[model samples]
Target: MPGALAAVSDPALRAAFREWILRVADDELVIGHRHSEWTGFGPDLESDVAMSSIAQEEIGHARAFYEQIAADEGSDVDRLAFDRAPAEYRHAALLERPNGGWEFSILRLLLYEQFEAARLGLLAASGQEPVASLARTLVREERYHSLFARTWLERLARADAEGRARVQAALDSAWPDALGLFEATPADGVLRAAGILGEAPEAQRPAWEEAVRPVLQGCGLSIPAGPAREGGRRGLHGPEFEEMLAQMTEVWRSDPEARW
Candidate 1:
């Protein structure tokens, strides 16, 4: 398939596509930072190295997506990734939240990896050239992310009563934010209308639920019933996000003109 930019000349559609891409990139960047927090602090040496690698892969993924947008807009990828205001980021609130505990981070990773795999599947089938091809390539790495998360989740859940309780508590706290992953935006409608996106994030919820429910249930964890915490997609986020973004962007912001 031809690149969406070549196939679809509509400026609005292109803008919407850029917005959607930003959301994907932002999710990766934020979650990658959160994952990096586990680098030296993981429960074990193997897990530490594994999570560090995952963090690098995720940040690399974000850079790839940002490069796509930068190519389209004649902008700089570093600026796109590091200079955006906190409210300008389109990532779900879940990714920006603090990594509370090993259980919390593991469960969050499990939930997110499943959603990401499904989202990438949609992108791969969208026939939007570089983006579609990129999505396909990403799935290769994402599979291992899903595997690591699931394996850790199962181990933590089965470790003992306290372990199970901790995992359950993390689920209760994270489920609402996870559901926030599918919050919709006006740009999503544009992508759907342009045929660049087959399904809006909200529309993908059922399948995501189907994919996650069994894994979570198998761990003996109950899915929490709470309202989806929305607003990140629309540029609303909490102070914690502000703090994290500051830390993430500190060096770049301090020396924007310097070559990294």
Candidate 2:
């Protein structure tokens, strides 16, 4: 692997960098789309507007990362984002699952934001050029996202037994998928070996769990016990992802040559 990203000349290393970038970008894109679904349906007017802003911010983050990859690969950002087949996306399954309900989305956001922060922290000082810088800035945004999720989580937990049970159910269902966020691929080894990823995804897992456990337990939620579900990193996904990809790509696929 090259010390300088601009001087990356090895095919395998370049491929690994692309894979790492796509993993982060795809997560943002898919989760952004999921969040956008709540645009006009949030539990309140303020929440509706706030979530809409966060959704757009997530999409913007995705575009930034995609643009970085596009610059290197001589590919356009939209093509990289919308032109890919469903099997080509590298996002975790946690993000691709449908937003089951307000409780579900809030729980998923709480879990994912913690993971995202841990991920960015690993990259913060990795000396990985543009991505390190990107991570530094993105982590700030994630703090707000985490805060929003936590506030709602606490509210629901304290509301009543029914509210607490609903949140607990959502957390149970989402825990396995959230664990999948750290499922490593072969490319992860390449990045770790090259010092591009300061730590392995597996190493990040305990920290992620530790960060979320206190808050979740305080809310009367228990972490699900089991092996993490996998396959999303390798592009395997379920019907929900297929439906999402269809809707996401519809406008672009309608006329590939048309300008947006």
Candidate 3:
């Protein structure tokens, strides 16, 4: 683990790198939790199982990342995941928002999966040590996630006007939060200057936009014009997060000192 994460001598750069990693891990954790909620409530049996599998994989990714960070910082992974104050979380606001409906969840997944793929691709290309290897491995799973999202998106949109309208509405509502996925932060420039991060989050926005535009337009969905809903990156999250955290940490908090 020590060899995998090559030492960054500069304290600030190391701190920035940790922040970036936490953001990625938190995103995966929150979204995975949300996805897991659909385990038994999906539209059909096959979809229920598939979505559950995807949810589990996402949680696994989060665990892997948290483990890496924990090893580097001399902290425990479980504590890093559930012990942080809600405001300290670095995930995007889009991930914290409640799963409103099937269309909303599917569209959100489609948007997030694209951004994640591009983000991981950059990480994999950066030639960073353990993280690069991890990113490469995770990107493979992300591909299937992308495929799942796109497949459902296409079918729902093409099914009927009602289906298309629902998808469009979901797209419109989720657009601002989706844009927030690329909200720039101080750590971004620090990581970029250090060559630890391949591109600034904002710089990657154009590619992400281009990647999703055609698919969205084809689905008869229009990206809404609005300022990005910011704050999640800064640790500010929606009210739903309070409930989510409570439920997510309940078991752990119940026995913080108890052994399994």
Tell me the number of clashing residue pairs for each predicted model. Answer: 0, 0, 0
TM-score of each: 0.96, 0.96, 0.96
Candidate 1 regions off by >4 Å? 1-7
Error of 2 at 5 (Å): 5.6
Q: For model 1, what is the error of residue 34's alpha carbon versus the real structure, in angstroms, after optimal superposition?
A: 0.5
Assess each prediction's global lDDT (C-alpha) against the native. Answer: 0.89, 0.87, 0.89
Error of 2 at 249 (Å): 1.2
lDDT of 3: 0.89
Tens-digit lDDT track for model 1 on 149-246?
A: 99999989988999999999999999999999999988899989877789888789999999999998998988988799999889999999999998
Model 2 misplaced regions, further than 4 Å: 1-5
Residue 210 of model 3, lDDT score = 95
Per-residue lDDT for 192-237 in model 2, tens only? Answer: 8887788888998988988899999998877779989999999998
Judge candidate 1 at residue 245 and give its lDDT.
91
> Could you give candidate 3's per-residue lDDT for residues 132-231 as a string of tens digits?
8899999999988989999999999989999989998888889999999998899999988888788888789999999999999887777789888888
Q: Could you tell which candidate, 2 or 3, scores higher by lDDT? A: 3
CA RMSD of each candidate after superposition: 1.8, 2.2, 1.3
Clashes of 1: 0
Error of 1 at 254 (Å): 2.2
